[model samples]
Target: MADTRPALPPLRDVIARHGLAASKALGQNFLLDEQLLDRIAAIPGPLRDAPAFEVGPGPGGLTRAILRAGAKLVAVERDRRCLPALAELEEAFPGQLRVISGDAMATDAHAEAGDGAHIIANLPYNVGTPLLVGWLSAQWAPLPWWSSLTLMFQMEVAERIVAKAGSDHYGRLAVLSQWRSDAKIAMKVHRSAFTPRPR
Candidate 1:
């Protein structure tokens, strides 16, 4: 039988239609590399039927990868500017992709995710550290929700997350992460991979 599903427009076209340009102040950097996003999505272990939570899913690059990987994705994006782009992704995936337009930090991901969910993202550099701390600390509190975290930060931030005691990067972040759940630096992406590379 011939396939009759609507084809997704090119990402560039979506970006252009929505006027979605990388906003430095908003910590926006559109990931142009599909392979990197796929690798990031794969790091949290098998998606299968598990729900995946993504923060700052600007332009839905990583969001698309998660959907393609066969997981139900709930993406929280802060910028209203990108909501149209995300809406396109929601259309592409139908019921599989749910996008919330709001501040990721304030959104209760657990409430949206229910139970047995995995968190994965190419975190916005501006809020990455604080968000990681929030997630790690949440795991130790009365209501730990997510089963795992597979996120990307700046290379320096990645080092800090996986750093061990006595290592140069070791600090409160290292202690908190180690004290809670298993975590690691799953991958490193180059600056050039982003639409507006950060320096």
Candidate 2:
């Protein structure tokens, strides 16, 4: 059967119409590469019956990929400017996509995700470290609710996360991340891929 839904607008057009640009203070960077988005979305373990939680889903690039991969998505976007763009994604995916407009830091992501959830995100560089720490920290009376996390950070940060105790990149992040959950650097995104290059 042929699909009858409307096609998505070009990413550039969506950005222009919504006045969405990279914000330095917000650590904004738009990842327009569809292939990369798909790779990021695929990082979470098998989707089968699990839900996917995405943090800082600017412009819904990764959000769309998650839906395309067949997992239900809950996108936590802090920037209000990108809400309209994310709304378009929700419409495209129908009931599969849920957009939460608020700071991901302030929200209890694990509680919001409920049980049997997996997290995947290309997090903002500025706040990525803290967010990861918060996720690993013991929360509530028992522990975190999610089963696993597949997230993107800068190359340096990625190394740190996957580093072993004797490795140069190993540090507090490695210790904490190892203690709570199994983690590793799934991939490395090139600087040219992002809309606004941050070196």
Candidate 3:
């Protein structure tokens, strides 16, 4: 049979070549498993030719999966160590992947990814809530600039974001996060899935 997978280096190989260690300071972890990445990519709905943005795409693990799903992805990486690896992904996929080296929290998502792009990210615990809050608070009249957000968070944090109204868990954060968009748990990842499992 002909080799059918996209011609991209394995995540481990890319990490080693680039010395891409998971930095606790930068809130970095690499999920080397592509199967889970693909599943996460699917939660954004049909992305064939659609615009998508990813935050902190270390070594482009989930970035590859998102490109394979046919979404045009723009990924913002804070750690410059991973930029070369992402550059490889950009070359492999051509127009499908764009790397922005900066803080994701500061990105103008719509301006960077065109109007109304979907965001899918396995965010750092520190960045997840605040990024969502920023996006939620964004001023786009008539409708929000982002079409949807599919994010990964610790189970407890996810609960807080989706907490039901009138329930004890509900709070201002939950209301603000879900007010403009309908959020849900797209998938649960195994704790061991991350390169350096969080304690």
RMSD of each candidate relative to the true structure:
2.3, 2.1, 1.6
Better of 1 and 2 by lDDT: 1
The true-versus-predicted C-alpha distance at residue 99 of model 1, in Å, is 1.1
Clash tally for model 1: 0
Q: List candidate 3 segments past 4 Å from native.
A: 1-5, 140-142
Q: What tens-digit string does per-residue lDDT give for candidate 3 at 66-131?
A: 999899999999999889988988888878888999998788887999876889898987788888
The clash count of every prediction, one per candidate, is 0, 0, 0
**Candidate 2: clashing pairs of residues:** none
- Could you estimate the TM-score for every candidate? 0.91, 0.90, 0.94
Residues 56-157 of candidate 2: C-alpha lDDT, one tens digit per residue: 888877777788787878889989989989988888878788888898888777677777688888888788999888878846335567878888788888
Q: TM-score: which candidate is best?
A: 3
| Rank by lDDT (best first) | 3, 1, 2
Worst 10 residues of 1 by lDDT: 3-12
Each model's C-alpha lDDT?
Answer: 0.82, 0.81, 0.86
Best by lDDT, which number? 3
Where model 1 places Cα greater than 4 Å from the true spot, the runs are 1-6
